[model samples]
Target: MIIRENSMLSRRHLLSLLAAGTAMGGAAGLTTGVAHAQAAIPDITLGDPSAPVTVVEYASYTCPHCAEFHSDTFKDFKAEYIDTGKVHFIYREVFFDRYGLWAAMIARCAGPENYFGIADLIYAGQGDWARQGDPAAVADSLKRIGLQAGLSQGQVDACLQDAAMAEGLYGWYQENATRDGVRSTPSFLINGDMHSGNMNLSQIGQLVDEASS
Candidate 1:
């Protein structure tokens, strides 16, 4: 999908969707190059924290398939499992390029509360925002979007420039992807088993049922 310059994905939209859990609690710095050899697999989670089944997804912002999953299957999944408190859905960024990483950073800036909302908007507007020629210009546009979501330009800029947080997120992503053998976007770890790419609602629901059972 071609992301055009006129896309509606603003920095705030990216931030709201991408930044989910980074701000909750204290800032934890991830150790670089740490793989399964260096540390145990961290349980990246979302939704009802105490939900019975946990679903973790490793996704890239620029991935079309991931967007499709978000646009198609995720809503039903959320309504059926996540909203019902049967599942905890965690999202992790699996960056394949600098643009993907930048998008991830912007999402992180929005923090957990706004993460999913912004993520929905970003995925919905992927073709427009991801295809822009000038990333900085795109970022500026995203910042304006964030303002609508209640983030100030100063906050957005600071979050975007947070190199330490970005590096730490990158390190976490690299380590998990390497361990999970994720070679594509929209990979999921449902109760510890790895599933690659977007799945239909029925397929994902079966997994949730199995996990609950």
Candidate 2:
């Protein structure tokens, strides 16, 4: 899906969107809307921050090809590069729809320490959770993933209902995706050069080696 085509999720409609099965609302006294235009959005990172190569991935949770990369390519990349301190990796969420946004919210709910782990679960179960066929059903599936990732019920509920955080995430995504020229899911910025579509571990390794050189 094209990145620039989607409209921003306005702050005024944020709560209603959540309450209408995008989230488990009734978060007591949650922020009504965006705190400011530049609210702090979480940037989930992996590997050594000072590594020679920086790989930024812009991906949507609902995208099948993205799920394929996670399931097939990411583990090896992480093991050979990220774990070895050869490359620094950052994961940026691209929301193609509210379902994608909701999945990201649940992953972020686990906090940065647990974010990647929850994200892994989300990607791994993308077929089941993303295709549940109704906002509430999909929402419930995401909540289950959050719970599976060790997030408490309270935490999941509060996180899903966080309007301010949601707005910040949407804004952050728009700015980053537009600036980085992302037009599709499973896109990568390898040391600032944009690469689109899925690549095998060997292909990714070649790029990593080139960046290193």
Candidate 3:
């Protein structure tokens, strides 16, 4: 519960992290080996566990820049670094608002198998969903995304209405933000070092290579 100022889910501070940047990588053909990540934690990571470089991302679902990074940068990173087992990438959710929280629940509802796909949809449709500014509508839209991923409305609703899960997620965020000095969205923890702001493909590639070397 060590949120901003040692408070949990400090909404104001968390928004700054989302605004911080719009912001990962592959698994050396071993995605399944590590696919069963720490389900107890609110993290969904992909890549070879023994990758030389570990990249942790702190992002908010509502952040447009986050959407852009996922849309523009992630694919390449995933292909070269992650898929090749050059880096391990972890995605930790940072909730800036209730819309984001609801979205997080929906993504989790889809389960690990469909998490990334659902996340892609959320980021790609950020404008359409967040613009509504109505929690109920946004929640419904998120549920649709889940349904398309083959989830049931009841399942989605269960995750959404489960206030305990939301708190747990927020707690996870607080721990990440505090431990990693995450000042913005898309902040990265590269091998335990904090690097804020979104990085381009080449820049990230070089960093990973350097770390590997």
Whose TM-score is greatest here? Answer: 2
Q: lDDT of model 1 at residue 43?
A: 42
lDDT of 2: 0.82
Pairwise TM-score winner, candidates 1 and 3: 3
Instruction: Write one digit per residue (lDDT tens) for candidate 2, span 65-153.
Output: 88988989999999999999999999999876788888999999867998878888999999898987677678788888988988898
At residue 83, give the lDDT of candidate 3.
Answer: 96
* Model 1 lDDT per residue over 89-203, tens place: 9888876655676666666666676777777767777788788876555666566555666777777766665545655566676677668776667788888888776799999
Model 1 alpha-carbon miss at residue 78, Å: 1.0
lDDT of predicted model 3: 0.70
Worst 10 residues of 1 by lDDT: 24-33
How many pairs of residues collide in model 2? 0
Residue clash pairs of candidate 3: 17-184, 17-185, 22-65, 23-69, 25-82, 26-82, 26-83, 27-82
Q: Please provide TM-scores, in order, for all candidate models, with all chains considered together.
A: 0.75, 0.88, 0.80
* Model 2 residue 43 lDDT score: 87
Question: How many backbone overlaps does candidate 3 show?
Answer: 8
Comparing 2 and 3 on lDDT, the stronger one: 2
In model 3, the Cα lDDT at residue 41 comes to 56
